[model samples]
Target: MTVTLKDFYADWCGPCKTQDPILEDIQEDWGDRFQVEKVNVDEEQDVANEYQVRSLPTLIVENDDGVVERFVGVTQREDIEGALESAGA
Candidate 1:
């Protein structure tokens, strides 16, 4: 199973900026266990709309099955790690 982390964000979103470093740390720790796809809501409105992202810094953890976890706003590292693990990353 391929676990993926879809990060919905916008350049002007403060919370999204806070979330960036957290995700970078996860990428460093997890390595190739999962893939991270960053979507700029302002540039990719269609993609954001498809996911129904109503807020900045929306994170979605998905695997082959489907979406396993979703987070809104700034999320903790541990919480994201837990979601990744659950998604078989």
Candidate 2:
């Protein structure tokens, strides 16, 4: 099973801009531990809706054990890393 981090964001969202780099850094730093999937809300509304992303920069962490956790808004990098660690990613 693989740990996948699904990030739902939009180009027009201000907070999403703040979140983008953090997740990018996480992807770079944790390349061996997890996978990052970016979903553009404007271009992929269906995907966002399926994940119930009502806000910008909604992050969903899932694995074979199902969804490990989720975060909305501009989440801190440490919290995300902690969640990944706890999920055994």
Candidate 3:
């Protein structure tokens, strides 16, 4: 199984930039077991609306089974990992 991580952020959001490294680290650590995708709220409003993202830097964790969790703002590595674990990835 694979863990799908969707990071929702706007280009103009500072926190979104701050979240880059954290996501990169997670990607590197998790490798192929996880998939990281970025969605710009402004550019991909349909996706943002579909996921019901209400704020910048929102994170949606899912697996082949579907959505597992929704996190708003910058989330820590451990938290993200915990969510992945919960998703059975």
Candidate 4:
């Protein structure tokens, strides 16, 4: 069961800008263990809608077991890591 972290954001979103590097660092730390994909809301509205994203920087973590968790706004690295741990990564 592969886990996926979908990052929903837009270029003009200030908070999303702040969130980018954090997710990047997390992605690097997790390596292949985490399938992190950046979803630009402006470019992928349907995908955002699929996850019911109502804000920028919304992260939807999903896997074969289903949606493990969701985080909105500026998320802490520890929290995201904890979700990874919960996903058995």
Best by TM-score: 1
For model 2, what is the alpha-carbon lDDT of residue 72?
A: 89
Q: State every prediction's TM-score relative to the real structure.
A: 0.98, 0.91, 0.93, 0.93
Q: Which residue pairs collide, candidate 4?
A: none
Clashing pairs in 3: none
| Tens digits of lDDT, candidate 1, 1-88 | 9999999998889989899999999999889999999999999999999999998889999999999999998999999999999999
In terms of lDDT, the best-performing candidate is 1
**Which segments of model 4 are wrong by more than 4 Å?**
none
TM-score of 4: 0.93
lDDT string for model 3 (1-89, tens) is 77899999988999899889988998888888778889988899999999988888999999989999988888898998899889976
Candidate lDDT values, in order: 0.95, 0.88, 0.89, 0.87
Candidate 2 C-alpha lDDT tens digits along 2-86: 8888989888889999998998898888887998888998999999888889987899988889888999889999999988887
Q: Judged by lDDT relative to the true structure, which candidate is superior, 1 or 4?
A: 1
Question: What residue runs in model 3 are displaced by over 4 Å at the alpha carbon?
Answer: none
